[model samples]
Target chain A: MVGIEPRVTSYLDYATGGFTTQYAAMLVAAGVCDTVACVFGANPRQATVGDSGAYVYDPTYGLVNAGAIAALGWTRYMSKYETVEEDLGAVAVTFRRHARLNPNSAFTEPLTLDDYLATPYTVWPFRELDICKVTAGGAALIITAADRAGDHPKAPVYIGAAGRQQAPLELAGDEHLMCYAMTSVAEQVYREAGIGPGDVDLLMATDSSTAAVIHTLENYGFCEPGGGGRFVREGGIALDGEIPMNPDGGQLSGGYLLGWLHQVEAVRQLRGECGERQVAGARIAQYATTGRWRTDFLSTIYVAE
Target chain B: MPDSVDIRANEANEAFEAFVGDHELRVQQCDGCGRRRLPPSWICPHCLAEEYEWIAASGTGVIHSFIWYLRPLDPAFLATPYNVTIVELAEGPRLISKVVGVQPGDLSVGQAVEAAFEDGPPGATTLVFRVRETADGAEG
Candidate 1:
């Protein structure tokens, strides 16, 4: 932060959904500024569950983001492939389990596959467990040049690569349901980082819905498209599996700080500061987010240095 | 529909609203590329052509995707377990609307659907879809 003195020469504000931290880091890398502070806060608790209820009513269509995502999830995955409830439930259950180890997480209780399945569907094909809890909070990140990092007390996580893409016209076309934009961004970031899915030790994905976790894995090439359901169900994303995802519990069980928390967790994981939930010998960490209604997608690779 | 006056309409979508008011379904057809797009836009996405015309749709399509809400996200939605569907028009564009004349469990992808309209608040009318009847007179 430039502080009350206002010594900073330039200021850039991002109202553009998630990926705030990554974009801020990019500014530092580009020499736009020696340091940048990215701040985020959301208080959608009342609006999401309250009087307005996150539903956007056009003259004819009454649409909610959660409901639309649920429909898209089923349309994209279940319609074409043979998938079970466990395929989707695994994401919620695993996140809650990881949350049990995260002291900062509000959702401390253990969630089993059965418990997830028992939850009622607020929207068909999406249980209450599948959606994120609307919480009010603030998160901030201080991104500085690599040379400045040596002055800090804590180990710095270097930004290896960053990529973001906005879907054409926000909500037009089938890209939102199909993860076409997500794949494009993921490929760009992975290439820039000179690594594949196998090289990353941890993945912190913004899980606004369980369906998002499944889609993220597929879009990032962690697994084949349409195979995410089976991969997650088979424990590929578990803590001891091939790739540990959302070790700090992600948005499903972690507080939904509009994806800022994922960046925070990714940095912390690469720094090896997480206590019980930490992945041993972690080097490369990946953080990703698909913006509200899948309108945009972003990925960043962070490595311990 | 909730009457909060929060309708998201502008110059780009005005043509669609006028057609639905007249109980007809139409989409924007690019004059240069012979392609169609909906939720009405000024330029063709495929060709970036500025000139376009509104042409009547066949009013027939297949159920592309759908979902049923167990509870209304907005209080104005009167019924429970109501379905919202996206219909992929035969002319090659998708529209978000509701499908009537069938139960939620019975509705499936690829079912034949045709355009239907309902009166909305004031001058506006809502565009919806219904399952087309099969040759034997059964609901499609």
Candidate 2:
């Protein structure tokens, strides 16, 4: 029993709702969770509005509710089913067709779906390929004791449970009338990880937009919230399918740091060390985080045995 | 003539003519739970109510969202890209103006605006909202 999820503690009122209430008070100040799991998403100064009119600034159409779009805090659970032009043109055409099959993608050339619908609207249903860019990264994680799995060198993943929820700060004044609180924190993290989102395989969430990663893969019940734009327009979540989300090009082609490097690439694809963005025999991964507009929720349930 | 900048421009032009002699864009309104208050309240933020009610706005509204800045984060707003909105008001409150004549690809979403004011840097005034012509006359 050595689980130690530190995940950034009090970085000076980092303010994205004080960095998920200081990373759930630094996972109960380090003795790693007697119960600590604060989560967050949608942070551009908490979906900005400060020209100071209090809440809801316009200064010329910056965020006029579609539930105050910053990609509705997880793309409003991918708009409960999809259609901001088919979940932003199928994730900017499947990340420009997987950045033409990866080249450390910072945008691997040819993008067209009319260049993701001519880019620029930043919110009204979303544009600029449905948001998420800001970069400058850092990531770290370490959790011990799955019966001290053969004393380290990589091979112990089992946590199997973690759930968090928040939702009220006067709900950002009905944050433009709600819906996507990651579908009740993905129904209490799949009923406290009793597991069954098709018994998971790999997901590493918190996209920050592309409609909150197609409504968090349809709020983690894995495809149902508007069926995540026909489950990513068929092909299910492509890297190989059946589960493969954010095989790294997440945070929109991998960069946005607020997701702690998508939870350090889900502990490097459960330690197989993601060489070509791995995802082979993954055994039940899942990591979720969203806050503010998605209303602060987090989830974790690893298992590589 | 710095007698403390002429007694701070005669106490801010007598608090801007007691808020335009009550046509009321005076703002404060939070007597605790009415909201419309901003940078002036003595305490009330939804029920803390120290008591306030300078209210008057019906100065009209719309816009609801906007952006244009083009790239100026301020070099004195570099040759003006401006626009910036979020109006709302029909007195239910929203605020954050300065739209002017419209351009940044002709900003749509509800349009119609009003409340102007201006005159800062001395007797100080500053409210800024423009893009008008609606009460049915059209042009949003």
Candidate 3:
């Protein structure tokens, strides 16, 4: 979605798909433009809906999709005894721990898994902790052509094959809700980057909610489709685990910028600027973002140049 | 059915709510291919048929999925730990509603449920569901 503002600056905002900044960056690298800037602002904490069941997080889609997340959990991955708290709770807290390391983050307080599980549900299958906080802020990134890249101070992080994929956007129509979207996105990125998931050194996926992080692990083939719960429970996504995902604190702890600020985290890591969250000697990484969980968006593979 | 169901966001949904006002569950059937759908789109997604027939639903299906909102921090919900659900209507369409006559915590996935109607926010009537039965015994 592109928005144009007529003024002294007169610069139009080019918002692409999920992890949209990468798409903008890809365009600039391919001569689609001379330079591109990606920025985002959000203040969901204050967005109000009417006095109906529609939630403040999203007055329109949140209520319905929250139920869908519940449905998907019961039918696809979980048993009746295992609630959303069992798996998603841990993931939420893990991101919280990461946020503690990120001083600029909104949720910097350390959250134990027990405290997260104890929080009452704001929406079912989603406790208040399971959802990213209501952050009111913006972040931006700039991408320029390789020839002009020398003008920048830091080493350029090359954009490899970046792919975007989507599932059936129709309401409640998706088959296998667990693997509907991420699986396809994974396939395309591997083909485009000439590398598979195994080669990536660091990982980042949608953390719109902890459930999303679980789905991303399975959907991205980090584990089997139904294995996300186990993968998460066993500490597969933690910073010290096999794959360090969202080490810069995901949207859950980092604050929500429509997951665009993740690009900033990714860029900083690639530039070796993240003093503490840095994946040791990280040369390759992959990340994804969604405009909304209901449908399509971009996933990018990055390599240090 | 409640005396207060007056809000229908669209003419098509206005018709659907009319059925709910009578304690009847209804869905749109494609006039062309006979496929049924819910959350009324006014047209059949299957065959591009603008024409459809509103048929009363079986008002019976198992719990497709559910969630329990544990607090009323948001004004949008009134219940502490409100039970929200997705009922897979026997006619093959999924409806987003809540428990009408069943205990919220007792709700389980794959349990049988049937439709019910009640007032929501004064002039609005909503279609909700109740436990029709369970694997262990009969419920509402």
Candidate 4:
């Protein structure tokens, strides 16, 4: 049956898609809407090699997504803590292993650290495997007010809290190299949710490049700053580890739907619906993403209701 | 002023670039607090003052971070393995440019650099940086 009346109340876009979903959720929370559909899609295949619309400036022209993010990783990890490039392979390997168990993932081929290292560097510090596969696809989620959430057939995933933090300007502050804004955003989200990093059962960080995974881990308090490379190399983000990250392979292998798939994975994990790639008895899940060069950061915490 | 100039600068940035085009690196200095900002601003971001002036910079800074592009993402930069770097000016603002006259692997954070200019296709002159050499011919 059609609804009594319907209207498109709002529409917007961002460099990152998860923020739009967060905005739609806030609309419902504020009683402005009964339900909101957040849809995200990208078609890099139809465009030229460097036509992503995000990086066309004079200074940033040649530093496309891969190189820009790899530069960030190199500055944070390689320059700061003496981290070797080979240590970054853990993120790709772990995510690929998780993708092997996720039927929805686009690239399910088994990947080992050696196999990941065998690939050529798309950028100096990143291989083709380190970058998200730029494919054409769409994914979406439905957000409803708390009162109407139970009416749905399946279990509802509740948004415990959401928060965003933006830097003053791109590379303006002294801490831009460290992306210090994300730490404050993480504190806000966790405090609002009445939880800590340890309380999170799983984490779904935007894996646009393997560097993003490292940044999220450290910025979200999962590990110390400059310690993300060591944490990943030691299996800290594996499915059976303390904080299972990207259990659905994230954008790395799950296909980059502008982080929409990560949100879906968080919901399914909270609902205990993921058969093999699920974090067992997962209750609280978190999803986080940042804009290019850490211009902004956004995070949302979800719990099964 | 040419139509082929593809920069992301707004009016403020264009004002700053105009000086660079004239072989000068200048920043906005607040008339009140004497604070300086890059890319030019009508108001001082630090003091929130509306009075400001363009002041010539020392044209020297330290390398904040850098990256080497093994593959060219822009057709204009057909040369493979080029570098993009962020330098923190001595006057306290960061600028994005390339470091010339050095191999990609030779640069490090905190290394000192001085400004150099490249006259681009008419009406476009850009700021490129070079490593500051000590009196002993060693990298400073």
Q: Can you list each candidate's DockQ?
A: 0.45, 0.07, 0.31, 0.44
Task: Please give, for residues A140-256, the per-residue lDDT of candidate 4 as tens digits.
Answer: 788888788888899889889898887777453533445677888899999999999999999988787787777778889999887888899989999999799999887777667
TM-score for chain A of every candidate model? 0.90, 0.31, 0.82, 0.90
| Of 1 and 4, the candidate ranking higher by DockQ | 1
What shift in Å separates residue A21 of candidate 3 from its native position after superposition?
A: 2.0
Off by over 4 Å in 2: A1-68, A71-110, A117-128, A131-207, A210-247, A251-261, A264-266, A269-272, A278-290, A294-305, B1-26, B29-49, B57-85, B88-104, B108-140
Superposing every Cα of model 4 onto the true structure, what RMSD results?
3.7
- How well does candidate 3 score on lDDT at residue A60? 26
Candidate achieving higher DockQ, 3 or 4: 4
Expressed as tens digits, the lDDT of each residue in B69-120 for candidate 4 is 7766555666877777778899988887889988767888889999999998
Per-residue lDDT tens digits of candidate 3, residues B30-134? 889999988877666778777888888888987777666665546554556566676788899887677765554687777788887786665466777778866
Q: Candidate 4 chain A — worst ten consecutive residues by lDDT sum?
A: A46-55
Candidate 1, superposed: residue stretches over 4 Å from native: A1-18, A42-59, A170-172, B1-12, B75-78, B120-122, B138-140
- The CA lDDT at B103 in model 2 is 67
The digit string of per-residue lDDT tens for model 3 on A121-174 reads 666556666666556677777767767877787888777777776666455544
lDDT tens digits, residues A29-113, model 1?
7877787777777677462343211546353566665545545556646777778889879888888888888988857777888
- Tell me the spans in candidate 3 whose CA falls farther than 4 Å from its real position: A1-19, A22-32, A42-76, A79-86, A174-179, B1-11, B119-124, B134-140
Q: Write the candidate numbers in order of decreasing DockQ.
A: 1, 4, 3, 2
